[model samples]
Target: MKRKKWMSTLLLVLGFVLYFSVNEPESAYAMHIMEGFLPMGWAIFWWVAFIPFFVLGLRALRKITKETPELKIMLGLAGAFTFVLSALKIPSVTGSSSHPTGTGLGAVMFGPLPMSVLGSIVLLFQAVLLAHGGLTTLGANAFSMALAGPVVGYYVYRWMMNASGKQKLAIFTAAALADLSTYVVTSLQLALAFPAEQGGIAASFLKFGGIFAITQIPLAISEGLLTVLIWNWLQSYSTNELALLQRQMKGVKES
Candidate 1:
């Protein structure tokens, strides 16, 4: 089973590289929806929408820190991991760039709300320091990549963990789908903002989704594989930390 999984992962990587080589765009925008890309109303709307999640995430993070200080390093590492992964952009045919969210593992480990905080921080850093994302679109970008992705990814991880019994498979699927979900949500946001003249929002969604999927699908798969590898490495080197995380997850599930 492990061999098969590795082989499949190799194939996926090869396919991603092949596709990237063949269809690499001449110029493309960086990831996270860019800055000032959305209208004032839409921007404010997303900011308002994200505020509740951000507050909840902040509370959850504080609780975690107060309750289990030992896990702080692990959580910091997870946040850094997400920041690095998201900062690396792959240009898409849609004239924009997409990248891995790195939210699935964090969501599954620390719960979705905490991941929301971590993801928001990453987005903020990218917007301000790297200039990858934008100040205006921070809310929209955070809503899609941080809140939506983690929520979906956490639930998917729960479902897969319950159904599969294969931890690797569950982790990979959850992480991959989480990454894809961000793009899906972004597509919807863009579609709603700039509906197609002929077919409206639905058509525009399809158009944006189709364009993003070309690069995003491969990125999702790669992130999934990377997540599994990271998990394996943690299991080997940080067994105690992993156990503590599992206990936290169990506590969350029970409560």
Candidate 2:
């Protein structure tokens, strides 16, 4: 894309993200586990689990910045889209709430490693500034939303693309599943932390998962549609960027 066009696209993406970032949140409650919500042991466990991925992601991110300097515009769009969509939290039937993962597009374009870094940055900012998630629970939140969702999205898109050779179908399915997967992991996290007296972790998982399903299923579908729309928009206006992504994608999964 031309400099003027890419700049315009960035402005629009940034504008949408900024509007929501500045908007007052509806609930003090939010999508991810809240501040000090997890036990210290679980918190530390999750933080430890998340660190390796973030470190690898940093390496992946550095490689991208150094090697494909031109694709930074698309990178910005991906980060902005994740921020804007994920920021829209809906209070769910559970004690907390749910929202779109918003990592699918980034995963599709730049792979999961890049999104691990981008998505964590999104979580970090939201935790500190928006009070949506928290510093203590950031690891749990990032693991579910950033790592799990994008890992699913990246592989699903690749599998779907190979099996069906239908870009839109692949994008929709991957994006929708990515959103749902985040809630699945979150439910598991919550379940492990607070097991039910009657049936233990299994029952608690069912309870949390069931409650999240009520709201999250529809949210995932809506996010899929929105992702497809944005994908189409990029296809139309960001051909150069897409071309760069195609080149990058070929090597993204290689060891």
Candidate 3:
């Protein structure tokens, strides 16, 4: 009952954010804050911002491992999945491209702890190797994409699954919601970091979220459908692997 309530609240919050984000403006920061949007001092300030959250996530992971061995493997796999998936960019606009973040699927299957850790790793690599994000903005990026995305995704997925008997429908709904929610959270972060004089927080979010929605909504839906298909396929063709994965997670938690 408590979990259900929490999920409901999360969905409501996500929905509200999405509604606002749909009207936000367009900027490179719409997808991610660039290398120099914030000055070095400010960027460094935000970069280290995720330290506390990372520590909390690590502690959560240790607690989770007490009950499951599979958690460690899942974390590793999630990191790998994010790394590989993000490395493959698909053309969005003429010169621009985007990739599936995969934080949603990770959170749904392995909980938010692992997903945060995994996402951080992937983002770090992307920043260093591909210059996809930014070194100074690492903290902001990690918090928005890694921590917030997965946590929201996990709760949303759980909520939808519990509400529906149809597994496929639940998975699809969760995936779409999670993807959309991640973008909304990103917009909120941008709004906070780069406040507008006239519009304030609400105005900033509206500007960034609106433009981001154009690119993100379709991508999110595609990601959601792919995730559902993959999950359903795994359930049917590779229950043994899924069982093993779950068992390993349980062992990681226990250990």
Candidate 4:
């Protein structure tokens, strides 16, 4: 796809998501950290930590789109998958809602680097247009859902695939763990920012994590199954694209 066309497509998706956010009737506390919720030090730290990966991701994105322009559609699909899945929020314990990170499918398909860019873009626009997450906390949210989730998901798929040669299992585990990893990292972020007086960060992490576990575990599993279905659809319907993708992602193979 042409660069201009890609930008237009992205904007179109952005518009749809904004409309969904604005017209939605129910409001629940966001699982995403709100604006100005984190301390300045922590917020800046996350931004600093997240920037290097995003920079590397930009390079990777450019290389892929320039090299094998066909995957542009696949790229857009991955981003849209994330936007759709993550936009779904279910009420949960505490003040926040639980939802799938939806990074695993893309991470498994395109690897983690490019996904960092896509996932971060999702978080950025959500923060700006939806007010779902805050600009100050975007770094933290992006780090958790984008960088950390995709890394865990991608590697888990690689490891599972290599070890067992089971594609379905690999995809499921990657998606589930990827979904879980976002919440885990987010829990850690909350714990770090607000450590328990008696138990400190570790104690607080367990507490924060415990709160999210109620909803996140089931949501993760559901996301995993849903991703497997999507993977199957692609495998059956887009054989040529999968073949091209296999070539693009070195070391990926069907077992």
Candidate 5:
């Protein structure tokens, strides 16, 4: 990126956002399902489903710490990024708003398993301190935004990197697509729990997905750009540290 290219990208994303916001009626702020909005069974199910990922992330974190204690600060900063970015809700054309997950950067940098723990903590803090999401729906939210998004994002980035050897392109694609993936999983969760009377699960999923895409797609594009900018800055200033992380990742892969 050149400055002109960057401006063009920003303008395009802004156009999408403005088009949706102007076209659709103002809606409720939404990212994770509102606190305690899901049925008890659904909530419990998501919690159970998320437990394995959470535990695996803890194990991964422990391993990383034992190997590279210097990375702890980086991990903390990544978690903070996720928390802060996700807290900013973009109103959508649908009745609910959406926001960026900010998990893709962590997934690309530290790997997805570690991000599961990082993302879970961010989500937890948001629910408890900010009242953005609910305790009861934590599991569902964690499953969708934390585990699912990061897993897909990590693989997507890796795949793109391997194929193109273009870090910026890979980062943008991973971040944007991962954000979309989170909402897709979220729509599925909502559909499964509350199927529409006419079209059932499929119909309900489309309804939810269409609604969230209004805000989410543009937010995803914006997040992708932001991630690239931040990563480029870090790469320029922290070349040695970034190399160390890359070496650690290589070591993990070899093992």
Candidate 6:
């Protein structure tokens, strides 16, 4: 089972790389190439982008597996849920729609490692079926949305939960922060991909950051509230579900 898991991950990574290489563009960044806009540089970028997250994910996995079997199953289910939900898109303006992405919720539930793997799966499916993001951009997109978002959200949520006395308040605050952090990190990724000609990284960041922030702010808030509501409701009515969550969290801690 362990070897099979590793092999499956390897195959997915290789397949992801191959798909991007065949479809990427020369000068354009992969993130900018929505759908059907393939570039070679973008392909190279995707390959380069995988290194850090892959390392982090491996380390995380090593740490995560030291827990109870039931916890592991819960984490797996959370990842699967995130993968499926994120693939469902809602209409937005600017000829592009938006989706929940689910990184924040996944991070809250299972931490970052599993979320990275889950995020990669979600992006892969989005590229292959929905044609939302791109094959070449999958790695970069996953890094930004899955890796960065979850890491940020996890830490932020942990901090809030630890600092606060009230559970509801902590959950609400964490949810909002996580959602906003996801969008901010995603914006940073875009800014890096589409740097301005005149000023440099800072200037490009400001420009792209402003536009992306305006576009994503409302969506982020809505997602945050929705996540909190759903999570709280689940925790309330579903004793088994809450027990499962606690088990997974214990596993994560032990690992």
Tens digit of per-residue lDDT, candidate 6, span 106-187? 7777777777777777777767876657877666677677777778777777777778756555555555555566556666
lDDT of 5 by residue, 128-218 (tens): 8877779999999999999999988989998998899998999999989878899999999999999999999999999889988877877
In model 5, the runs with Cα more than 4 Å from the true position are 1-27
In model 3, the runs with Cα more than 4 Å from the true position are 1-30, 39-49, 60-73, 88-98, 244-255
Better of 1 and 2 by lDDT: 2
lDDT of 3: 0.66
Query: What digit string (tens of lDDT, one per residue) describes model 1 on residues 104-185?
Result: 8898789889988899999999889988779889899999988999898889888988887788988898899989999899
Please identify which of the two predictions, 4 or 5, would achieve the higher TM-score against the true structure.
Answer: 5
Per-residue lDDT of candidate 4, residues 118-139 (tens digit): 9999998888877778899999
How does each model score on TM-score?
A: 0.89, 0.89, 0.73, 0.88, 0.88, 0.71
Per-residue C-alpha lDDT of model 3 across residues 101-202, encoded as one tens digit per residue: 767777777767766777788888888886677777777777777877777777776676667657667666666766677678777877877788998999
> What are the lDDT figures for the candidates, one per model?
0.84, 0.86, 0.66, 0.86, 0.84, 0.61
lDDT of 2 by residue, 1-255 (tens): 566666765666565445444442466477689899899999999999999999999998889889999898888999998997888776666656677778999998888888988999999999888887899999999999999999999899999998989999899999999999998999899999999999999999998899779878987887787787788779878789898889888876565
Those runs of model 2 whose alpha carbons end farther than 4 Å from true positions after fitting are 1-25, 93-96
- Candidate 4, TM-score vs. the true structure? 0.88
For every candidate in turn, the CA RMSD to the true structure comes to 4.3, 4.0, 9.8, 6.8, 4.4, 10.9
